[model samples]
Target: MQQPLAPWLEPTLNKLLAQAHEGQLAHALLLPLSKEQGAEVLLNRLLQGLLCLNGNACGQCKSCHLLAAGTHPDAYSIKADGNQIKVDQIRELTSALSKTAQQGGARVAIIWQAEQLNHAAANALLKTLEEPAANCFIVLASAKAGLLPATIRSRCQNVALTQVSKAQSRDWLQNQGVDWNTVGWTYDVLGGPYAMLQQQGQERLEQLQSARKEWSNALAKGQVSATLCQYTQDQPADSLHVLHWLISKKMGSILASQRAFANRLSALISEISQVRQQLAHMPSVNYVALCTRLVLDYQQAAKQ
Candidate 1:
């Protein structure tokens, strides 16, 4: 067999290979792995092995070398640039799938963050999944499997990559020469082996932490509306956390919960959903403005 790539994924790799070896593999494989779980690396390696001409997982084969060089003709990958995976991209992939494999073997297509597909794109891809070509494989990787269509999910073999032990991850990082001081919270932030080695700038993490703190303080001060809006706008991505924090704080005040805090939390949660819906429609919305409004509204509701 070809030398194992990503020894950490050897078990999963072996399981998949055994299926392939038995000629009982499914056309679609849904790998629901977290961002830091090294899902992408596993996806690439799996495709490489499938495409290897020797049918033996040989990394030294001509096809394997092409994959290492990032020039594999039969392997394709798609990822969202900013927003959703557009219908055109899926259409193109579907058309490409119709053609015979360049290596005259397996045709592999991978979609990163596949759940980011918009309604139209999802529909476009559904047709292909329903009637895939012979010797073709589709891999969809996402952190949130709930976001994908149930129909699509039901058709694939779902493989969830769970969190590895923190001690094991830390040990692996040390072996990789990661500087813990400079990379403080990297483990908590990235969550695994695939994400540990990534270099993040000191300032960005600090800025996000500062924003979270400031937002927390403002909520405690009973600031509602405009000020809350400002905080939300400044940290749009953290909107979910901000709302959750408010709910947690209010939960302690049973009297407050009885008074009106519960209603406020409910309303804020609804508003948060609306904000996400709006963002899905118009991604260019002012993040600061949106977040500020949400925070302020929740603050006002809590006081009642």
Candidate 2:
């Protein structure tokens, strides 16, 4: 079920709902891709509104109940099955759209991490986006929209969202009774409280911090390969994200550090980015070995 929109996003929601009410809503709506915003919740809110019977989503209608149960015959979600949204998934969605909605109402599809659509998958989906099905609405949101094909992006109506101010985020967190340090770290690491809490919770703070420090020490000591192999060789999918977040968190400061440090960190970040792309797009990836190899490559490149 979709949660209520945050105060900061209510305006955007209202604007879209207005368009929807007017029958002028685009078949595809591209929400903010930034981590600072919860685009999914916004999209869900819009979908709930569309499904509501009384124009106002009282959370008491049959459609609302179905949505809450995730059995909304008309609503579907497309997200990463493993690491990518494959062509088959897109095809399934298309087929589903071609049929009349089970409830004989609108057809809605939410594409989470739309940027992760593989080339073939994206191409296949592009045709549908360009020539939308009747009463079909697609919502695509991603922090890495830049990675999506220009053509696919062009077909959607963009919903612009600005980052929430720090003061506002702080107040929100305080109201929620989040401790000061977590609020601070969440802001620093994840860009805002909402993203931070979603990405990392209080229970994970200590372990994540320890992991980050160990990786940093390894990076500094030129032990990248060994460090990655030790911690990531068994579960690279999970390990790599933790490692990546740690490195990503420090990249800004690294870029501003001394010349040698900046050069090395830049090289390391590049290697991480390349491997991350491969992990996302390629099938049958040896996640553990790939991460280890990338770390080794980063070490060599960083030395240059």
Candidate 3:
């Protein structure tokens, strides 16, 4: 059985359905979603609604069956080959979209992580975005929509998904049999209900909490602990996120009385962000040294 649409996503789905009902749905849609949101669930619901013969995603129709079986000729999904979506992938998509829908209904194409589309692939998709075929819909879903070229973003209708509130997320997690008290901090770090749930079972919450405590103790002692350094080395991305959160929290607490110290913390936070960006785009960058430098910087700020 298909899961129901997430409570937070229901409104967006309703709006899209209403648009489709009025034949006012755009040819291209840009969905900016974070990991915390139920992007996959929303995407599935949207596609089914568009492809369903009854216009309601009834799940009983032949079109729904084809979609469920992943054999729907008119529905196409594009994903990054590795870190990037190549020009060839976009070319193949355009070729398939040029043909009429085999099911004689709306043809839907979804590009997951559309921000990962390389320059050539993005360029190739421009013409299709500018002039789509009849009954064709292109959906570009990206966690970092700003990374996509302005030209591509300008051509598509931006659909902003509703962010789930902390109260709503806590209630939902509790309903799912999760112990909110134990996993609440995970939610704070991830800022997404779905992401928190995914990481909960993997014991990431415990690791992060431990790291936070260790870092706090080290900050108090005016030194970076070897264990904390090891943790950062092991999990560079998670460590950086935790570090950012910790420094931000510290900065906020001291912003009123310790302006100079807070300013230093703020600078360290900015440097951490730069290191994160460097690691993301340039994997060969020396993250270990960067992480150590950030920790030392945090210690210096704490001493002041």
lDDT tens per residue, model 2, 183-224:
464355454666655644554455456556656666566555
Model 2: CA > 4 A from native: 1-4, 199-201, 208-304
lDDT of all predictions:
0.71, 0.72, 0.85
* Reference-based TM-score of each model: 0.64, 0.68, 0.83
Of the candidates numbered 1 and 2, which has the greater TM-score value?
2
Which model is ahead, 2 or 3, in terms of TM-score? 3
> Higher-TM-score candidate among 1 and 3?
3
For candidate 3, lDDT tens digit of each residue in 171-197? 988887678887676666676788776
Give the distance in Å from residue 256's predicted Cα in candidate 3 to where it truly belongs.
4.2
Predicted candidate 3: what Cα RMSD to the true structure?
Answer: 3.0
Instruction: Extract clashing residue pairs from model 3.
Output: 36-192
Off by over 4 Å in 1: 1-8, 179-185, 200-304
Instruction: Give, for candidate 2, the lowest lDDT window spanning 10 residues.
Output: 231-240
lDDT of 1 by residue, 249-293 (tens): 565565453746666676676766676566657746765555556
In model 2, what is the error at residue 79, expressed in angstroms?
A: 2.2
